[model samples]
Target: MSRTIISSNVRSYFASLWTATLYHAIRQSNWIAIAVTGVFSLILFIAAEVSPTEGTWGISKASWLSVCGGVFASFLFLCIQSMLSALKATNRDMYKAAFNELVEKHGIKTVFSQRGSDDVITLYRKLLSSPRRRIWAIGMTNKHFVDQHLESLVHVLTSYQIDLVIAFWDPSTTLIVRQNGGRARSIIEAQSALEGNPGSKWGETIRQRQLRIANAVKDQPIRGDVRIVNVSSVTSFSCFIIDDDLFFFPFLANTDSTNDPTIYCAAEGSVGRSIIDHFTKLLQNSEVCTTTYHQKETTVVVPMT
Candidate 1:
């Protein structure tokens, strides 16, 4: 009775261990390794069990079994490693596809070169040629951009109603200190460095330029609103959304917006829709001032709560 009890206990321990091990292996989805291991194990067992009455091909059963056993062990180890590699690769592919699936499908064009196939100015000209599209532009109200892409800008401004968001963060409080420490001088310093006596000339010059552009948009034959938003906290990415088409580029800490690589896509697609939604949210949350020029000039200042 004692011996039987001890035998049963030993069998139960092994049964549980085998069950756990098999469960873990299957759960890992190591099917190839498991299949190969089972087949090799069966072959090894057969070779060991067969007793050679006579030599076949001048090799004894003992030698045959020894060679087969070593080969089986090697193969089992290789299969397990292969299975791990396969799993890792599968996981990596999934994440890579999720993040860059749009880039792969739509293709990312670099606008680094002005004369290349990926030139942004050329692309802008091509995209903005559609007269039916509503244009939404968000960036620093830099006139240099307008001058460089004059033809495209003219087409867009004249073609349809243009919704423009100009950045209005205080230079002294925000960009001058945070982003352009040495490269940018304070208003006081710049005034003092002037050819004449120090005054509010620098500030006036900036205000005048901003007003000039706002007035230009207001005077256009097509109707649109020029809005000012504080984007110091949100982002420095410049975006140009032409109807369903969108082109965006990020401003690096020490680089120009024009030099940055622009990403373009149709706003109706998943990625584009998400981008459009985000833009709309930003607009909703940040309307510091708006000037409309449809029938007549109308300026509305949204008081910050």
Candidate 2:
């Protein structure tokens, strides 16, 4: 009788253990639990069969317990698997919904045409979910010319209420400029020329051109909160974020007629990937991706800061 009671308690314990394992597996979407429970059940079944006193409880009772335990375990495993599948489906649906919302709100015509579209989209959705407002523009700068993309950039920054703008200057192109006839200038010098050019009519003409560009997009004003930063230095990380919203990187391309502008806009593969990796680390903590309008092969991953 004592043996019978002990066996009964053991059966009850396994039943409860299996039930708890099932609950956690289903709730947390953990697959490891299924394996653990299966192993544990196997061990229990082997012990029952090999124990010398098994017949003392009667073969009928032992068989019934074995069947019940197997059935319960199987049921729990199936239920957990079903729940996990459902959970995955639900997550995909939620991501799709959020992406659609972003498109409607910001007028994002397209996203993620590259190798890691799913991952990129997931990161993008996470970043957009945040309350922070930031915009980042990646372009080139050199001694002779600054890429004229600033006008479009200002419009984007303003629209996003960006608090900062990080501009990446590629050193490789600048080296090319130095090798050529032109010399590379510091960011401060470039910025001074841009914002506080000397009292020359030429400077004034450039400023007027800038103002006209700004005026053309009167519908979108530079956000009062935005500030420009020129990042001429390259670190282990190259990506920069404006208010945690936008990411920018330089891409290697064919240089134009003027050697000076080459450094300002030339894209170097090594430098570009380094910058992307850096930003990927930063954005991943918050779950975001660096997306582009024209490129289809690039994938942006947010890295750890």
Candidate 3:
């Protein structure tokens, strides 16, 4: 009972001390006070560094000062430049300017509102799911639209030889195990470790997803091939070319898919052709993915004997 009472008293004292300190801190907090304190602190720091005691440091005083001064000057310059840029043109203004430039250059016409996923889905179906379909697409390593909304449409493309330029990552060992089967994941992780980058498992699940699609393509009744090229780069946009129609989906950072804008361009237009050409360039730089395969089975019936 005595020990418990003492412990309670000790806690109460500390709580009171904290409360007093917080009260004083809040009372003293002011812009003028802060500025004055900062200036004095800077001055004291400078004096202490320059008026150093006799010490045999590796770097000479002059050389160290010169290097520190240079770093400070560079940092100051960058801060000033950033402030000027922000003042001159805000991020919103820059985005508007870029949008206007693109619109003017491409003579773009907004077909549908760039608002929701449904809008994009409607446009995709109208363009890609026609009786006669001709399409080429460039998208993220693991494209959600393709995986989620367009699964049924995917089987149709199995009859046509499609080209894919995917931005794939090196997946981590844990992720590989979670996604792929245990046996396959163990082998993959062991092989990856042997290559001297055990922790380099950036995009294993995405690669596996793409491989699944590739294998599915190979299984179609009409033999169709999807040539996958894996590139190591971050993509800010996804492009799909259906016949002469082009759809562009901008990747919005820190936003859900429902908020991201999907743009549609006519194939005969200059903007559409330019977008297609850009996708072609991306395709040219990617490394071919030759991991997935489809094994054909044969069945023979014996004559009545």
CA lDDT of each candidate? 0.54, 0.41, 0.51
The CA-based lDDT of model 3 is what?
Answer: 0.51
Model 2, span 54-153: residue lDDT tens? 4535665487467649855885876667666655665565567666665444333333333123454355345434325554444433212123334445
Q: Runs in model 2 with CA error above 4 Å? A: 1-133, 141-229, 236-242, 246-305
How do the predictions measure up, each by TM-score?
0.49, 0.26, 0.44
Each candidate: how many clashes? 0, 16, 6
The C-alpha RMSD of each candidate to the native structure, in angstroms, is 13.1, 18.6, 22.4
Model 1 quality (TM-score): 0.49
Candidate 2 lDDT for residue 260: 17
Candidate order (lDDT) = 1, 3, 2
- For residues 1-305, could you state the per-residue lDDT of candidate 3 as single tens digits? 99999999999866755555444434443434444545554554474476666322565556555655665565555545544444344444545665776665564657454535676767776665552545555554445645653465455554444432333332322223544464344323343454443543446555666667555544455323344444333445666666666777765542343455667777666777777776666556534322223222211111111
Least accurate stretch of 10 residues (summed lDDT) in model 1?
288-297
- Candidate 1, residue 42: Cα displacement in angstroms equals 4.9
